[model samples]
Target: MDSLNIEPTEFTPRINFDPENNLFEISGFSRPENVIGFFRPILKWLDEYSDSVLSRNIDFNKSLLTVNLRMTYFNSASSKFILDILLEFMKYHSRGNEILINWYYEEGDDEIQESGEEISDMLGYPFDFIPY
Candidate 1:
């Protein structure tokens, strides 16, 4: 499947989901006007991918997934949706998948740091923080 790339917008975060190497990245500020609509296709795609993996007997758990999150800021509404996206990957973790989240934050960015920590705490797999 072709990757999804959404440009930076006043309300939406830039998205770069690459399936070739299973590397997905979402960065920039996010406070989308229509949160669910903005994320529906992405969530749908992941759902289909999961189904495909199971039906084809494709061990996607063996595939490496590197997720990069370098958001400068996000509203609380966006935060909830982002967690939904992350949970998709978390599902694979239970199936023996190798996934890593390289979460970067600005120095002294307490909000971002705390946000990352909360997700990391909730994640099924371990995630590392990379402060810049």
Candidate 2:
């Protein structure tokens, strides 16, 4: 029942780390002054969680990791930090663990859809885009 749930604030993104269910979610805007400082802990959490899960889940016959993202927009500076997060998750995917990332965007957002495509191309991470 390990979880790290952080509420959304004016300067930070919301984080819901539910390892027991293998359901992690990150949403809200991210234009913080120090993006590195904000996301560093989340990245660290993921790393440690990876180690713990690998040790306990020998067969991995349980739930899989599902990252649900619904970011409206992000600043140019935050892009790199977010990129790191995606890459970390991709590692789990590469290891044969089921990884599902859902990218939700508002309707009629061609730019966002195209950006999603760019991300899929850049990271080679398969994402299911859902229009809202």
Candidate 3:
């Protein structure tokens, strides 16, 4: 499958989704004017990836999906979409997929860490909190 790479902008984040390498990352700030429009393609890509995985009979056990989130700030609307994205991974995990989420935050950034914790808790998935 082709990878999805969206450049970061003043009001958006950088997205890098590589299925071949099992690496998915979203970094930078997210405060787009149209939240849904900014994230719709990502959600669609995830859905397609899920379908392809199933249709291709990929081995869930051996496929390790790594998700890295390095967001410094985001608006309330973006938060909802971020949660939705994580929930999608949760569903993939529930289906016996090996997944690891790394939430990266700057040093001494309590808010970001807290947000990550909250999201991880909501998704019922364990995430490694990495302070950089």
Candidate 4:
């Protein structure tokens, strides 16, 4: 599958999903004018990626997919979509794919940390929280 790389704007974040490298990263501030419009393509890309991986029966045990989420700030509208993105990765994890989800929050930022924790709890998945 081809990689999905979206440059970050002032209101949106940078999205780099490289299947070949087994690394995915989303970072920056997310408060786009049209949240749905901004996130729809990302969600679709993830769905397609999942389908591709499953169809090929790729062995992910040796090379785990690493997903890094480094968000400085995201509005409430964006938070739901962010949660949805994580849930998609959770699907891969549930299917016996080794997925390492790293949630990066700025040091001394309790709000971001708590948000990640809440999402982790909601999905019943533990995330590696790293304070940057």
Candidate 5:
């Protein structure tokens, strides 16, 4: 599957999805005026990628999928969308895919760390929280 790269804007985060390298990253701030519009394509891409992987009979056990989330800030609406994205990854992982989620937060930022913990707890996924 082709990669999906979206440049970061003042109100949106940068999205980089590279299947070849098995790296998926979303960083920066997210407060898009149209939250749903901003995330629809991303969700679609994940669905397509999941389909592709399933159809190709790929061995996810041998390859790991790494997802990095380094958000400095995000609005409430964006938070919901962010969870949706993570849930997609959770689905992929539930299907016996080897996946790791790395949640990065700035040092001294308790809010971000708590947010990651909350999401991790909700999804029942053990995420690696890296404080920079």
Candidate 6:
């Protein structure tokens, strides 16, 4: 599958999904005017990625996939999409792929950190919560 890269905008985060490197990252603000329009392609890319992994039956333990999410602020709508993105990754984890999700939040931002915690709990996945 091809890599998906999107530059960050004033109201949206940057996206860098490099399949060759097995790395995915999203960071910055997210309050898009059209949330679905902004995220639908990303979700589609994830679907294709999942399909590729499932088809190849590749072992992921050797090269763990890493998903980094660092957001300063996001609207309620964005939160739902973020959860959806994480849910896609949850699929890989469920299939025994070695995956790592690093949820970064500002040192004093309890809300963001808690949000990550809640998502992790909801998905039953472990995320490394880092404070910056």
RMSD of each: 1.9, 1.7, 1.2, 1.5, 1.3, 1.6
Please give, for residues 1-132, the per-residue lDDT of candidate 6 as tens digits: 788989999999999999888899999999999999999999999999888755486654545789999999999999999999988877776777778999999999999999999889988888999999
Scored by lDDT, model 3 comes in at 0.91
User: Alpha-carbon error at 10 in model 6, in Å?
Assistant: 0.9
How many residue pairs collide in each prediction?
0, 0, 0, 0, 0, 0
Instruction: Report the lDDT tens digits of candidate 2 across residue range 70-114.
Output: 877777677777778889888887776788988888899887677
Q: What are the lDDT figures for the candidates, one per model?
A: 0.83, 0.80, 0.91, 0.90, 0.90, 0.89
Q: Candidate 3, which segments miss by more than 4 Å at Cα?
A: 58-60
| Tens digits of lDDT, candidate 1, 1-132 | 677788989878899988777888999999888988888888887787667752354654477778999999988888888899999888866666678889899999999998998888876456789999
| Candidate numbers, best lDDT first, in rank order | 3, 4, 5, 6, 1, 2
Off by over 4 Å in 2: 60-62
Which digits, one per residue and each the tens of the lDDT, describe model 5 over residues 2-121? Answer: 899999999999999999998999999999999999999999999998898644755545467899999999888988888999999888777767789999999999988999998899
Per-residue alpha-carbon lDDT of candidate 3 for residues 5-121, written as tens digits (9 for 90 to 100):
999999999999999898999999999999999999999999999888634755545577899999999888999999999888888777777899999999999999999999989
Name the candidate, 1 or 4, with the larger TM-score value.
4
Candidate 4 per-residue lDDT, tens place, 1-132, comes to 899999999999999999998899999999999999999999999999888765477555545789999999999999999989988888887787778889999999999999999888998888999998
Instruction: Please name the candidate that would achieve the greatest TM-score relative to the true structure.
Output: 3
Error of 3 at 79 (Å): 0.6
TM-score, structure 4 vs. true: 0.93
Which should have the higher lDDT, number 2 or number 5?
A: 5
Looking at model 6, residue 56 earns an lDDT score of 80
Better of 1 and 6 by TM-score: 6
Off by over 4 Å in 4: 58-63
Which pairs clash in model 1?
none
Query: Where does candidate 4 clash, by residue pair?
Result: none
